[model samples]
Target: MKNEEKTKKRKAKRKLSTGLYKLAFFYAVLLLIIGFTLGVVYDSFISKGMEDEINKIIELSTTSEILYASGEEFCTIFPRTMKEIEEQTWKLGVMIDELESKNRIGEDLKLKYFDLQVRDFFLVKKASKECRINPLIIMYFYTNNLVECEECYEQGFELAIARNSLLEKVPIKIYAFEGKTSHSVVNYFKEKYNISSYPSLVFIYLEDGEERWLKEEGLINSNQILEKALTFQNASS
Candidate 1:
């Protein structure tokens, strides 16, 4: 009777051990799945947060206004191809039509005058191998109201005449205040960099996906503009 009781006790103990082992295995698998799921969720959240931050920085920092203005001015001053000239003519026509529709006859005439002046400025049959600087500077001469309209017109004419003599160099982008406005592109750069000048030249260098600004004085001439461009090129290199 004692042997029978011992056998029953042994059987009960073995069943308990087996049950515990099964429970532990199930729990281990569940924990591993839970840990992997949490890890994936955390990683996704972190990646999304980083992308948002990067987008915000781009929105706040990119100087698209300046770039656009510069591009328009470039097209106005020097069109490299026939297509560009046609586009400029179309733009002038549109401006004339708009001004006439507004009953601004004098302004429409001035627009026509300006269109002719721009065409004469850019219609050089022979481009000097030299004077390769970007034509945006001439555009600034026209766009900036700091100078009188007549003065701007004369400057554009003079620039065209001197185009052959000036040394050809790569284009350097400079930002100037358009008017006394709070949210102007110039204001944006000034607020960001504490700039205090009318025609501040901000040199930007992009390295390893980071932008770095170089300290430089304002530009008035083509030479200073070229120097700033070279500085940015060297730093980026």
Candidate 2:
């Protein structure tokens, strides 16, 4: 028993020295503190920037009636505003990617952003209809429910591919939303489309001068999106 106790004491003594242990611990804590501090700073900056961006986008919906008047000079604003919207889309996309990389694609903020995108889609569609311009749009519905939406991430990735591919050839607007969100507008769409599962899609476009809205459920790949989009757009053989 004395030998065993002696060995245990020796092993304990072999561990890091008290001062060294404390110093190492202090360094570790210091690093963690620095990391957390930087994270907070980044979050605050991003949140403020995003709030400003959203407010700007919302302000866009209030363009003067003169801009929408049925005059060639007046109607020029549509294309300009659309271009601005597209630029804003790219900007928001970059911010979203940053958030996603940080594992901080936060719930309410992200959903609110998506909802704002949907509102933008509505404005664009309305303007297009008034101007007799054909507008191609897709509404992607997904849930953040971990148990329910296993493929939502894949769906989003595939969607990005399809969006990039199609944008190379045609003008299209794709809006994604958390279908099960508590927001009344999103919830209304969830009920309207009978969304029971994850990764549902709705395609809206003008066909034969008539607006067509179609729905597809389950996980869809980029190829499928391209195919359906081309078909609904009346460009597919």
Candidate 3:
């Protein structure tokens, strides 16, 4: 019976090993399912928040009459609102980048995002003019490396530094557009401004109560152009 006992013990050990492997596999599958659920939940939460922020901006833009009526009060309210809007816009940009990288964002959504951004720009520009503010617009057109956009980021950075040095008195607005945007706004801007290059930097200033584009001659030396513009503006006013 010793032999029989040895066989029974061996069978029991094999059964225990199989049971342990099954348990480990079950736990592994459970962990994978849990992780996947959490990721979905997190993504949903972020998307909802992003949608809410975008909607608020749209609502604000749509009711621009309220903004126009602010008069002096508009300037008081503008800085804070602009900061919030810019922050949200930056976040939206990050989201767009991520979605685009994954090939998940659709053309419709991309166009809508660009539309909202452009709408905000016009609203801010109009508000600045009504408030008698000299607004500077620096536009960056990046094509996600699909095409060569030489020095776009560099120019944007240099302009940003210049803008920051101005001490926030001037309403300097910076906007970035994916040149490959599946929207008409890109074409509209290009046609209106005679923009031909990918990394083209356009500086817009208010002149004689109308929007005017700064000359190309002024652009080659970026900082000098801005300084001269500032000096001329200061002397003019």
On TM-score, the leading prediction is: 2
In model 3, state the lDDT of residue 122: 82
The residue-by-residue lDDT of candidate 1 on 116-184, one tens digit each, is: 433333332111112232222222212334442324334333333333333244332222222233333
Over 4 Å off, model 2: 1-16, 64-66, 69-74, 97-108, 235-237
Off by over 4 Å in 1: 1-176, 184-186, 207-209, 218-220
Tens digit per residue, CA lDDT, model 2, 2-26 = 9998888788434556998889999
Displacement of the residue 183 alpha carbon in candidate 3, Å: 1.7
lDDT of 1 at 76: 37
Q: Predictions ranked by TM-score, top down? A: 2, 3, 1
| Winner by lDDT | 2
Listed in order, each prediction's TM-score against the native is: 0.30, 0.79, 0.64
What are the per-residue Cα lDDT tens digits for candidate 3 across 73-102? 677677667766766776687686666556
lDDT of 3 at 44: 62
Model 2 vs truth, CA RMSD: 4.8
CA-only RMSD, every prediction: 24.4, 4.8, 6.3
The lDDT of model 3 is 0.65
